[model samples]
Target: MMPASSATLHVVATPIGNLGDLSPRAQEVLRTVAAICAEDTRHTGQLLSQFGIATPLLALHDHNEEAIAGRLVARLLAGESLALVSDAGTPLVSDPGFRLVRAARAAGVRVSPVPGACAAIAALSVAGLPSDRFVFEGFLPAKAAARRERLQRLAGETGTLVFYESSHRIADSLADMVQAFGAARPAVVARELTKLFETVLDGDLEALLAAVQADGNQRKGEFVVMVQGAGDDEDAKVAEGRRLYARLNEHLPPSTAAKLAADLSGAPRKALYGG
Candidate 1:
């Protein structure tokens, strides 16, 4: 058994879905900590109850994280070991607790990680996309225009892109992705991961959109959307050319727009003009 030291903060990763995924080390840290700082006290309370752990729970979510961080840091400095956890998965990976971790570090308190489950990483492991180089874009903007704008910016990215999305907006988000990244871009939609109804669907953007639209069930769970990155230099050039063509086509004829976009982006005019 490892000894819990004073003036240390243990960052524990809980289960994303299946409770069995929580590591033995994470459970040990949770039991040994002076207290567990959670995004949702009640939710974490339930988990602790299952394990018969009696450690006290303290709420520390986004709204009051800044205010609570300082006090928590003081406690850590005063020799009270604490554990930080989110509702599910790793803390600070689209969840809260960054401020507390940062504060503890600044106060010269040791902050340690008991890593286990992370939804993004979990999804990426089975995504079948290029995982060597990828980007995790937490949650996109809630608004359609903002989300589309963000997708447009990422359209040219060469590394695989991962995103967390809610069920309510999955359809619209996929539609926006189809528009921004093109219908043929390979993508995967992993839903309800590690849960009873876990589903992982992979296909071209348009096909995936159709699958989701055809089934209401596909739109009912938490989602991790992984999009294959732009291909080689030639593929990137074509993507850039298409983006430019989209804008210039609005103000110029199709042939003229294709020519200008190709010249500016170093793409082939024949490819842009569909020749």
Candidate 2:
């Protein structure tokens, strides 16, 4: 434990899949920190054992982060330098530790980042899609209806769309994406990233759905799905407008739904009404 004035919180990134991807700095930080707060103690304990880093492990996950964050911050304030890590990849990227990090920062304790392999960044690097400006919608709703609603809201986004999905729902998610974004929208599915059996599948949304359905292996691992942004073409706008109109028509009159969809999708009112 360091002095109170010198104590800090190190937010370290662990390997997403390939253990070799863990950086020396991350390993060093984990080895030296008074204790490492992990999303899963048993899982992280194995990782620590692989590197022979015997620092203490503390369980800090979504279920308990809020309740324990204050206590962790108090320990930092009392001069115990600590580290935070998730089960995989960076902390707080669709993982736990948001409360702990915020608590430490608000307590005036220093918080540092040790960045490494992130599935989103890794997938983006090779997806060949626009990455300069993109949105990371980590995991969509698990249910089909809620998931479809979310996709519909993002239908008009002009930047790349990235998502993390589980193996169980990958097929259904891709199907909903096809319905919302159109079958021809270009997309890529990076599965089992950084690990053996890693595969990156790319094509239109329809093709992606078909591929995943045809190949059972494609739906068996963690996935990072990237979709091309909505284009500025007239056809694209009109297509988006039709999707919006259909959804809005459920809650509003046809004329009102068409007007609102036209306004939101930037398609002509006549186009929405098929004039």
Query: Where is the poorest 10-residue window by lDDT in model 2?
Result: 1-10
- lDDT per residue for candidate 2 within 95-178, as digits (tens), equals 998999888877788999999989999999999998989999999998888898889888878899999999999999999988
Mind giving the per-residue lDDT tens digits that candidate 1 earns over 1-275?
A: 23223568999999989999988898888998899999999999999998889999999999999998988888887789999999999999999999998888877788899999999999999999999999999999999878977887787789999999999999999999998788999999999999999999999999999999999999998999999998888878877887788778889999999999999989889867874
Q: What global local distance difference test value does model 1 have?
A: 0.91
RMSD of 2: 2.8
Model 1 TM-score relative to the real fold = 0.91
Clashes of each: 0, 0
Once superposed on the true structure, which residue ranges of model 1 sit more than 4 Å away at CA?
1-5, 244-260, 268-275
Worst 10 residues of 1 by lDDT: 1-10
Clashes of 2: 0
